[model samples]
Target: MTTSTYHGIYAVVSRIPRGKVATYGQVALLANLPGRARLVGYALSALTDPSVPCHRVINAKGEISRRNGGSEADEVQRHRLEVEGVFFDSHGRIPLELFRWRLYADE
Candidate 1:
């Protein structure tokens, strides 16, 4: 993807508030790149800026998607989310209904 595409992804990701999560698809849509969920994930995986809060983005299933770095990355993402008051069930799935960010026009 172009740097512009990645920047667009980052811009949307930066808006995900603490204690809430957004799906990859949601971020793509918000970034005006609909149907580009995988691209969103790819862009996030390529992130180097600590301010992006890439950990706040999850799968539509509300599960932390395994990265190229494997379980360690997943664990880190989960820990960060948990610290933000987002919990997962025995199935390792977050309750999206409760924790998924409902973006408002003001945000």
Candidate 2:
């Protein structure tokens, strides 16, 4: 992805509010790069900005996707989400139906 695409993904990730989550696909769509969910994940994984809050992006199933680097990254993401008061189900999923951001409808 180009630097612009990476920044676009990060920009969308940064907007995810606390206590809510958005799927990678949602972020991609909102960023105007439909079908780029994996690209979104890639950009988020490369983020160095402490305030980006990339952990707020989950999978379609509301489960944290495997990070680019492996388990350590995934663990860190999960911990960050938990710290933000986002609850996980018994199966370790976030339950998108409950926590997924409804965008304009929510605002």
| For every candidate, C-alpha RMSD to the true structure in Å | 1.6, 1.8
lDDT leader:
1
List the lowest-lDDT window of 10 residues for candidate 2. Answer: 64-73
For model 2, how does the per-residue alpha-carbon lDDT over 44-102 read when each residue is reduced to its tens digit? 76778888877788889989888445668788878888888888989999978778888
In terms of TM-score, the best-performing candidate is 1
Candidate 1 segments whose C-alpha is farther than 4 A from its true place: 69-71, 105-107
**Native-to-model Cα distance after best TM-score fit, residue 54 in candidate 2, in Å:** 0.3
Displacement of the residue 96 alpha carbon in candidate 1, Å: 0.5
lDDT of 2 at 72: 89
TM-score of each: 0.93, 0.87
What clash pairs does model 2 have?
none
Off by over 4 Å in 2: 68-70
lDDT, candidate 1, 71-107, per-residue tens: 5978988999999999899999999998989987225
Any idea what lDDT model 2 has? 0.84
